[model samples]
Target: MIYADNAATTKISDKAFEKMLPFLQEQYGNASSQYSLGIKAKRAVEQARKQVAEAIGAQPAEITFTSGGSEANNWVLQGVTKLFKGEDIHIITSSIEHHSVLNVCRALETENIKVTYLQVNKNGLVLVDDVISAVKPNTKFVSIMLANNEIGTIQPIAEIGKYLHGKGILFHTDAVQAVGHIPVDINKLHVDFLSASAHKFNGAKGTGFLYKSASVDLPNLVFGGKQEHGYRAGTENVAGIVAAGYAIEENVKEMRKTAERLQAMVQTTVSEIRERIPDVWINGNAELRLPGTVNLGFNGVSGESLMNILDLKGVCVSTSSACNSGNDEPSHVLLALGVSEEQAKSAIRISYGKYNTIEEAEYVASAICDAYSKIKSAI
Candidate 1:
């Protein structure tokens, strides 16, 4: 099948898989133990931590491994809330954040924590001014995503981080969709916390990292073992961590070239689709979007129906965020961008990856055009 749903998850790289094999086989040992084998495992985990930290321009001690992006996001938010006491904790986030962030904010609301869900512009770009205006004396944290998962709009994270730094509020970014696919420098972004998932970057699932700036102090979420320097507690997934580190190392070495190729493919596909299908609306900021993502809406055509037809033709696409695929509700991101309910329901997200070729993109675009034609005729 032609897999165009890379935003959800990319296939694990062969290099990462090779690095994981030894850990899964003979190198299996609890990282918390002090025995010879355990010490070896512990060293491996530390080495992986160093590699991950280097990728994000963070210190080795600042990186905390977690189950995935969701856990990392939750840990940061919970840690912030715990450390701030009952000082009317407030959080600033966009309306299009992943459910991981949105649900956490909803739960925080029940605890009397104030939250401001900032609106996005027509291009799905969150305004830095809106963020500044939303901050109040009680605003303790600002959590925004570096790149949107559904529409691929890249946020002004560095700008927002600089603004929040002087306000004494902690800044966190969900970089799950941006880590390996784009350049991410923690120091440059000036973010206190950043979340990334391994599966999003051609690595094994069940492994991710949260980058916490050394300057920011927060409480530990898991309070058991001393794994991750007592910041997080759990037996380290040695194999997955090694794989994720190796994946990051390999991808960063060739990110620029890969991104350029994907960008060209996306531009070509968008042009072809617009030419074939009139009234097609491209969602999100056209110029500042991620190289591999294209969200489009075809008037009068349901995204679900088009997706089904494309799937039968061996193409995979998503009608909404992968985290909320089964839900029939319109996309919150699109609505936040001023799209109508009908436009939101007709939107489809197509994200490319390192494995996809220009030929595949062309074919997928053609198939999408065909699918829409068939679905519209049937209606």
Candidate 2:
């Protein structure tokens, strides 16, 4: 099968699975326990923490393990905002953020916390000046995705983070889509917090980490035992995390080469698909997109139907975010870009992984052409 839905999730890598195998069997010990096995598990967790942190240019102490990126994003949004619970506070976020970030912001709004939903351009690009204008006196934080998941629009995180530096307002980024695809340096971005998921790259699912600046402080989201340095309390997933660290490390090591290959595949896929389907339009910023993602709007075609057709033919793609799957609603990301509901409904997301080949890309392009034609003819 040709899997083009890398944005949704990825298969585990050989290196990751190899590193994780022992922990699942012989090393089955609670990291919090005091026995020799437990001590070994704890050490493994710490080593994983250091590996994840080093990959992002963060200190091991500043990184906290979570179930995934969603948890990390939710915890940061709620935890940081809780610090100003009684005060008149505001948050700055874009309308195009993933539901994890968007839902957290919406939840904050219900609590009477002011939230500024920054608008994006037709390319799903949030301008830096718009962010500047949205800042309020009580604006406590800014949460933006480093790269959009649905459309692959790479935001100006560094620019926004630099502008917010020393302004007494914390900055956070949901970097789940960009973490393994690109180089990420917290110091360079000047971000106070960042979220990333291991599954987005090739690590085990249900494993991710949050980067919290040393100067930033917030209450624990999960409280019971002293885990994650009293920041998040839970028995660490020793195996999943060991796999995550090794996976991320391996991904980072090969990112430059893999990214190049993915980009070439994207170029070829887009060119061939658009050539075959003349009315198709590429979504998001053309120059500032992720290396391997392509969100396409097949005019006069149903993305859902197209996805089903592709699936039946041993190819996999997405209509939008996996979280919003089965909802059949227009993508918020597309809507934020001012796309018509009809066009948004026609959008299909295709993301390539390092393992995907140009031959597979050509096959996907051909399948898309067949699916779009067949679907349109029936309509």
Residue pairs clashing, model 1 = none
TM-score of each: 0.98, 0.98
Worst 10 residues of 2 by lDDT: 273-282
Name the regions of candidate 1 deviating beyond 4 angstroms. Answer: none
For candidate 1, the 10 contiguous residues with the lowest summed lDDT are: 225-234
Task: Give the per-residue lDDT of model 1 (tens digit) for 1-379.
Answer: 9999999999999999998898899989888888988898988888889889889898999998999999999988888999888687888999999999999999988999998999899998899999999989888899999999999999999999998998888999999999998999998898999999999999999999999888888788789988888888888899999999999988888899999999988988888898899789899988898899999999998999989999999999999888899999999998888888999999999999999999999999999999988988898
